[model samples]
Target: MDIIQDLEKRGLIQQTTDEEGLKNHLRNNQVTLYCGFDPTADSLHIGHLVPLIMLKRFQKAGHKPIALVGGGTGMIGDPSGRSTERSLNTTEVVKGYSEALRRQFNKILEVEENENSVVVRNNYEWLGQMTVIDFLRDAGKHFGINYMLAKESVSARIENGISFTEFSYMILQSLDFMKLYEEEDCTLQIGGSDQWGNITAGMELIRRSRENQDEDIKVYGLTVPLITKADGTKFGKTAGGAIWLDPEKTTPYEFYQFWINTDDRDVIKFIKYFTFLDENEIAELEEEVEKRPENRTAQKRLAEEMTKMVHDEQALEQAQKISRALFSGSLKQLSGSDIGQGFKDVPTYETAKEEIGLVDLLVNAKISSSKRQAREDIKNGAIYINGEREQEINYTIGADDRIEDRFTIIRRGKKKYFLIDFQ
Candidate 1:
């Protein structure tokens, strides 16, 4: 299969250096490539998926993928695609974050004990050893002030105050490219469109480093397009913050729902960018989306594929079960974890198991404003506890009411849900 052609068709390739040469390189042999991911957060988010999936794409195409963790460069945050300066993380914190990111990527990009397996690398090995003097003498000298200002990353940050540390990020990334080129023979670098400046800067370093020796050596850079929602807002953002890959930060159910709720306008594009399905499968989904938009078959498939890849079959089943139970108002079969994910966003209150009298609990838990309202709600049969209608004002919550003796699901009126923790 022509992977580059498929990527182009999916609208993934935004910018490239020597497209014809890159296509030739991938077609002819197993090309070694790398994409640098800065460890700015403890967990990888949906925004990080584009380049990560790009690495997986190349790996699937029988190319070598080196996921470069920015353990060293992460100390000095990259100013690309940021409106303000990032708070500097301590060396210890960066180390922790880098390890976490490596773990997450290791799961996504399968690294088998084979010749054509994905590899993980950290820039700290070399960058941590280099002195400020060596860095300035080696990489800083090659970068001209005019040339740096010409790059979009630096220019955009010039208006806003950008620190010297962040300003030197391009040099660090360039050094990464050079280091990988020397050690792993990685000739290509890929990233999001925002990384174009740093990417080309890396190519320039490679070219300058080999100026006298084998100047004909070809190093390329490719970038995926910036993802945007069909509504013209930013992707990976919601009422909650970013959709994190870590199940703790963002539950598997939430992650699956993010994709399952994709707008029809964006599903086909996402199916292409995110899924590994062949053309025929995607074509079939496209037809389903066109024919029956309400069925949400495309969205469900996208959710299933992504959830299974990120989490596992067990986690996917849990997410699916939570979704189904919530939709049908059938909460009896759900497990504690499932209920936790479903009611994570709902209002929560804590009370002793014995103290949870339905009427008093509603008022005290703020589900109802007053005792009168609580009584009226119960009399009107508008209260449901654990998916069962409750009209008795004297109803008392017990161990039986708790899902796994931890949580009690309380439905106020029809749609608003509340969660009560029974200690």
Candidate 2:
């Protein structure tokens, strides 16, 4: 199936303008479409995944994609998905973030040496050069005040209060599309459903500016559904924080674990949304899920593909190794690197290189929260060292217990485990 049809079947399309005409245009020619991502943060989160996945899908189906980093728009935050005004990021910060985001995009999309190798563009090139007078006359004149006020991004925020800077966001974004249309001949702008107003504004700007021109342009807009969870909460976030693409912000092991722990209800939906596995293969996996949910084949595939895409093969392997070791009572094999990379977030405590006993270390690491409780748990056969049950309250772990002369794994009960790193 074509990319558009496949996306529709997967329920990716939330809205589109000129659907029939756009499909007709797509049928005749491989269209060039663009999506903009603002660098609101240093790393893109899983919330940004839908548009990106769709971009790759289009690229795979023989259409070109332009990945626009909103280096310019990052200065003017979009109010579409927010209830309050955004704090402006410094120009230097935005520049650094934009560069990092583009570099990360390289991992997700095959954007080189292919028929539809993606093009990366920054809006600051054009937006920064335009004078206020020229911008108002050329681009601003095409938009009406009432129309801008009517937009949900603006209208919904008026009661709570919206900033003038955010109010002009679409005008700047529309200018981006107009510039791309004039310079790159881009005919389609695609984004999340929240972007419909801004996208149509671009189409209107193009039509208003090029009226009665020799080459008539027909720009299109398509939007994908915003991700949500089965329980009606947001996707890609938890009590810990937003799951980040950067391993430093969120470890590869944690990222892989997030996907691996997807609820059974959400796994099939995520497979349809995130993975490129074809319908038949997904169906086969779903059938296997019926027989053996414990195997979690579908969830594992999701974790492997996404982790490998975001990080790399070595990182994914390490993450899997950590996972297996953690789950299968093989903590003895955890090397120092694994302790550092895998248990970076797991609660840890330090001990003097000479005087660390197992029970004392357990209490320090918050395994039992108190020395008395630690002793009780240890005596009751609930405490473990390197995945082996330890009942002795006075079991002092010297340098011999260290994984690589630096760390020891301590377990409380069946599920909770802590890493003790010795200086």
Candidate 3:
């Protein structure tokens, strides 16, 4: 199947300027397409994965893909999906964010020297150099006030009021599309559903700039659908916060858990939207979901594919080990690193590396209300040390209880866990 058909099967295509023309464009030539990512944060979250993955899909189809980092526009910010004007970042901050995003894109898209390898470009290279007079005369002249106001991005913000800086962002983005088309021979731009107005504006600028030429301009735009959950809540979010792509922001283990906890109602659609699994494989997974929901086979496979893709094989293996150890309550075999990732969010207490009575240690660590409570808890077998039942209130927690001589696992009651850090 063609790239468009594959995207269609995944329910990825939300809007396209000219579907037939784009299909022919891909069929006849190795189309060079581009997708822009704004550096609103230091790291791109799971929210940005659809477009990044779409770029990969194009590259796999023998088409050249360009990952455009919005170094220039990011300083100004886009008003497409916001009710309030964005606070502009300083030049240095935007540059830092731009560089960070460039590195991430390289890793995810696999930058290499080849005919259709992903090319990373920063828009600041051109937009930063263009003077205001030149920008107004060249790109801004094509975009009339009425045309700009009619766009949903601009119209929706009129009631709430938008700054001139953000109001002019569409023109800046159009300049990117025009510049890429003139320099890189790029004929397609793709983004999420919110970017449709901006994408088409770029196409308009390209056509209007070359209106006198007796040639048909073939610039086109496509957008992926906004991901929604079956339960009416947002996707890629939990009570903690947004699911970041950077392992430091959200560890591989945490990332794996996020996918593994995919709601049963949304699991199948998520598998299609996120994973590159073939139709046959996906169909089989669907069968597994229907026949054996208790096994959670589909959820596990989704987590594995996503973890390995974003992190690596080792990271996936570590995440799986942590998951198994947590599920089975057999954490004694876990290394210090495994325990760190698995129990990252649990309560922790740091103390000197010395042997202490179990009741006293519990009271000092605030695990128990007082020495009497600690003794009662130990006597009732409600406290466990290193995953083993420790009912002896006088038991000494020493070198033997520490994992790697750095950390100790303390469990109180059924699921309440605490970490003891030995300094």
Off by over 4 Å in 1: none
lDDT of each: 0.91, 0.87, 0.93
| Pick by lDDT: 1 or 2, better one | 1
> Which stretches in model 3 have alpha-carbon errors above 4 Å?
none
Candidate 2, pairs of clashing residues? none
Q: TM-score for every candidate vs. truth?
A: 0.97, 0.96, 0.98
Best of the two (2, 3) by TM-score: 3
Which TM-score value belongs to model 1? 0.97
lDDT for model 2 comes to 0.87
Stretches off by above 4 angstroms in model 2 are: 364-366, 369-372
The digit string of per-residue lDDT tens for model 1 on 1-423 reads: 598998988888999999999999889988999999999999899988988998998888889999999999999899998889989889999999999999998999877988779899999999999998999998899999899988999999899888888889999999999999989989999999999999999999989877889557889999999898889988999999899999999999999999999999999999889888888999999999999999999999999999998999999999999999988888878888788897789999987767467889999899999999999999998999888899998988787888888888889878999999877
* Candidate 2 residue lDDT tens string, 1-423: 777788887888899898798888888898888999999899999888888888888888888999999999998899998998898999999999999889878878856987689999999999878899998899888889999999887898999998888999989999988988988889999999899999999999999898878766789999988877888877998778899998889889999999998877788888888888899988988887888999999899989988888889999999999999988989889888877777787788787677677777776678887889988998999988888899988998888788888888888888777878778
Q: What 10-residue stretch in candidate 3 is worst by lDDT?
A: 324-333
Report the Cα RMSD per candidate.
Answer: 1.3, 1.6, 1.0
Which lDDT value does model 2 have at 374? Answer: 85
Best by TM-score: 3
Model 1 root-mean-square deviation? 1.3
lDDT of 3 by residue, 1-423 (tens): 999999999999999999999999999999999999999889999999999999999998999999999999998999998999898889998999999899899988989899999999999999999998999899888989999999999999999999999999999999999999989999999999999999999999999999999987899999999999888888888998999989889999999999999988888888888889999999998999999999999999999999998888999999999999878888888998898888899999999999988888899899999999999999999998888899987899999999999899999999999999999
